[model samples]
Target: MHSLGFEPNEITYGSVLSACTAFQVPIFGKQVYSLAMKNGFFSNGYVRAGMIDLFSKNCSFEDALRVFHDVFCENVVCWNAIISGAVKNGENRVALDLFHEMCCGSFLPNSYTFSSILGACAALEELDVGKGVQGWVIKCGAGDVFVETAIVDLYAKCGLMGEAVEEFLQMPIRNVVSWTTVISGFVQTDDSTCALKFFKDMRELGVEINNYTVTSVVTACAKLAMIEEAIQVHSWILKAGFYSDAAVGAALINMYSKIGEFDLSMLVFKDVGSLKNPVVWVAMISASAQNQNPGEALEIFRKMLQESLRLDKFCISSLLSVIGCLNLGRQIHCYTLKTGLVSDVSVGSALLTTYSKSGSLEESHKVFEQILERDNVSWASMIAGFAEHGCADQAIKLFGEMLLEEIVPDQMTLTATLTACSALRSLQKGKEIHGYALRIGVGKDVVVGGALVTMYSKCGTLELAKSVFDMLPQKDQVARSSLISGYAQNGYIEKALMLFFDMLMADLAIDSFTVSSVLGAIALLNRSDIGTQMHALIAKMGLDSDISVGSSLVTMYSKCGSIEECRKAFDQIEKPDLIGWTAMIVSYAQHGKGTEALRLYDLMRKEGIKPDSVTFVGVLSACSHNGLVEEAYIHLNSMAKDHGIEPGYRHYACMIDLLGRSGRLKEAESFINDIPIKPDALVWGTLLAACKVHGDIELGKLAAKKVMELEPCDAGAYVSFSNICADVGQWEEVLKIRSLMKGTGVKKEPGWSFV
Candidate 1:
């Protein structure tokens, strides 16, 4: 009106102030207020109330309060503006004080005043104050739908679900906001069941739900992890066109991800297409990480970065986890530094974990020390890092330091410390930690309990391990696997089999580790009946494609003397890794199929899978068994020259056995002398056996003497020397050998057959 040269009246100024408040343009509102003051229109009670509303909505509570006091109008509208603004600005206590002063003064509280005060009570979590406000609403007869909704939300926020429900039921009329408030309150309080029930009630009453109500219902289903209910909610979302909303889409993605439905999560994300925001991206990235697809997760992270999207702490932390690529982690660390997020404890903890899990222990320690202030998560990350890397002593030492600092260790910390104890087999320390856990009331934590079971089992106390397992409140997959592994590792094959069958009967989802543990027991027993049964189960469960399960299957079949089944298991792997390749090669070599073993080795190389130390050992053993001395020597030299795999004792032993069995005793002796490291007893034993085989008595005596000097208690060495002497009719030497054996107290092991 001023721009058009029309004299602006009080109504025009009031309308402009309200617009400024709604748009949160306080600077413009201030200028407009100045203009109104010059025009002598600012004294109007309506214009003053608009100014108070403007300042309050702009988070300028002091300004709003000044406007309220400067006008000195006994107007309730101005009072309501200042009160609601205080609550909006996070000054809940101040808002309550202002409301009290208003009530004690000439002004009577209105519906807006009651609504604002109730909100303040919710923010403060002052249930008693909120209840007083509820009584005030009742007495004032100002309980409109908005005020009543505020009352219900306050009760729910304070965890008084019964009161919240009573208030909701008493509402004379319900609107979308009122229904949404109750549902949101329940979801926030973790009462998803109640939240769903209320949502159903609201729907049956013909009340309409907006985007927020639908989102809350979806979140409730997510909390329940109820796939069927989630599907029904998803259908509602589609029919109601809620799927296009960013928050609802993100919620759907997260819900499906938690339910182990990755494909559905991706589908929801894809359906959002160009509408995807940071929330959707974070949900998808988190889904991939949780689903064990670290590679895919990283790819999505890269795409997000390429799009120039900003990353928050949650996004960075999620990416840091499950990031197998060290270079990428370093890049993310640099980004965090650039964004000044490294100072954030959560991001710092994630960085500490990433470096540790990536096998950079020194870097992990450096990150740990750089953190200015460490929380429990930071301390836990460092301790868990040390534990996972086999630095049990360091892990324990750091844990002690953490305790000395009075940092309360959570369940994760206790679990990590127990894992370290298990690795060190420090039963005494493990017991002390267990006592601490019980004292701290975390003894029943599923992860901590599982760790304790593993610790006891590894420390050679299987009975204690079983006791802990039995006492666990809930035996999750980890606990079951821990006990099963203990039994399998300690030669209790029958017990392991019994527990595995029991687990199956209970309808527990058998994971790769569980299957692997059971397969190990079957292998140790050499029972093809059980082994074949497991193999069939593996196929049925679609676990034949899993690398660990596949490898165990191969070994179990080979040990049971079913070479065909072993090959079949090997062939089932579409793209075998180094471990799978090595397992198959060893299976062939053990069965005396040296030719097939060599062929597999070549095929593995053709597939571009670099051979590790174990792979080389298998091929060398095959060549030695087939008496291919030249081939064995070529591969052994290539191991160090081409692959940079320095030949270890096993490789040298294989070479010695190869030449000695081929009657090349001199070459075997020369090879032993050429070994870079000191030859161990196994190396000398191979050479001595070859000496006896080739009838080189002098060389055989030298090798026998060296073996005795290396390991005097080696029964195989003494036996070989005795047999060589007897074959040569050296009676005096034979008597001397017998005397040596008797004096040394060395006894040969009693052999047993596996029928």
Candidate 2:
């Protein structure tokens, strides 16, 4: 047309500018703007509005504003164009400011103008300003479905769910977008029930629910973990012929995985016609990881690699998490490096955590250092890695550095730092972190609260733990169990029992950890009846086979003197982990079944269960009880050589008892001296008691002296030494010890025996 010598009018220029905006061709839009200026048609209102829209859509806010200010006669279209342009460019605050400026003009805002302004308010989550705009929209009769939906979105994003729902109900008409927006808002607010109800109502009203609406509904089902509702949504999706929709497919996979319906998740994954969709693949990988099928997740990852599918950071991160095999994790890391995603923050963080979980903190820290744009997750992963690896000081140091960098720690970061504090038992440092959490408004976050409770509990401050527990708005199972365990550990048996009952009455879901905690409390209370009842409850809940629950049941029954019940619980665990094996071993040792305990220990090793420090304690105790002196020494040496577990104080105490009970006083004394750690009171007490039993008069005096040095005037130490002297016919020595006790005001209480 240009070559034919037809002169372009304002309408042609406006049409070209609108086309440029639609195609997001800013350079061509500028060329059109130039042509309009050359023809003296630049100031045409329609052309000017088109230019502004074109520039804004291209994110040229400066150019858009220039056109807006240069418009010779600004109308609502020009103003709305600039306002909407500002919003499109993510200059929401600027958009709101422009609306204020527009309000000062002679031209009043039309529905389009109001809609743009409401959108600005919603983007900013400015509830007060949104309300004002909403009122203006109502007064001007501009509250159409579009504007009404924006209002609902604004309220929902601001956490005013009631106001959002009220506005949704008041809307005179609704479209597919409006319905989807409201449902998504409810889902965002974590009101899955409300979101589902709205979806149901929308379907009953014969409103067409599109793929976006189905996706949101599926998300709500996933959040609620309601398998039935998820299946229902899945059916609706199938009926709507949207089963192949990527978002709906991904959501269904996530929902089924979260509900523990692995078969259904696989079906959804298989139904996704485009396995090439990275998002759907990511959802499947994440689902496998969440469902504790790490090998399957790796298989999916391998399949993705085999098909040459591009893996996103999310997919890499999910696979990194569950690939606990160190070699596999390193292989993934190498692949990430090859893909040039090693520097990606999410992947870097996941790699750090994966290496840490694989017991390679050095590699974890290397990955942490390689991440340039470290976000909250990156910092959190490093801190948690150090904490989990028992590098408390390093974790705390990193946390402090993170703060100094002015990065706000999220809940996970705080939880990791609190865990470090718990490891160090630094009560003061823990208090400082608690203060920080309160300042940062994550004090009541479920995970953070649970960490605080555990930190305080482990620090021997049950009152503070309970106080933190009480302050939590929602008592998560971890928080409840931590407080209950604290109470039980501190001998507040009744308080622990009461809290457990309260948790049950509140209908909080009882997980394995909670069941174990309550059973331990019952054991401490010596309530055999309650223990029996708890056993029944465990069986009823189908938790009897859970390893931790079964182990706790064994300990509980053993402590309550029900060895048969303890054995029964032990026999119930088809494949006991180290804890279950250790529990049974300790139970047998306590019941004078040393041979059985040692046999179980040998079997545990044969089953490839590596014995930890606790298991070593049980084994050593068994040897000590049966007077297997040489066997005890051999086992103690094997603790470090075979298992890489060093002899702790408990192990040393057991060794001393083994030697002393077998009348080997000299060797017991030498073993105490050879202990790597500073021997505590238990060590000295064991030797002192052994001295009395074996009639070693001189060694008894030395052992008593060591005990007194450690315990500072222990009456039992004085009495034992005096008895040794009396047995040796050293009347003078006995009198001296008695006088020393009298002078020191260490009164010996009358001995009593339960049996």
Q: State the weakest 10-residue window (summed lDDT) of model 2.
A: 223-232
Model 2 misplaced regions, further than 4 Å = 1-147, 150-173, 182-211, 214-275, 290-292, 440-453, 462-480, 501-515, 533-546, 572-575, 666-681, 709-711, 743-745, 752-755
lDDT of each: 0.87, 0.87
Q: Evaluated with TM-score, which candidate comes out highest?
A: 2
Clashes of each: 0, 0
TM-score, per-candidate, Cα-based: 0.70, 0.76
Tens digits of per-residue lDDT for model 2, 1-755: 77899998878988988888888888988888898898898678888988988888775678888888875556677888888888887789889888888788788998888778888888878889988988998788877877888888888888888888888888889888888988998888888998988888998999987888988888898843587777777787888889877878888898888777888899878889265787788788888878778787778778878878887777788667656678778888989899989998889999998888877999999999999778898999899989998899999999999999999998999999999999999999999999999998899999999999999988999989989998999888899888888888788888888998998898888899888888888998788999999999899999999999999999999999999999999988867998999999999998988889999998988999988999888888999889887888899999999889888888898888888878888888888887889998889888989989878887887888888989976898998889888887999998999899989899988879769
Error of 2 at 348 (Å): 2.5
Pairs in clash, predicted candidate 2: none
Cα lDDT tens digits for candidate 1, 614-636: 99889999998899888887998
* Lowest summed lDDT window (length 10), candidate 1: 272-281
Candidate 1 collision pairs? none
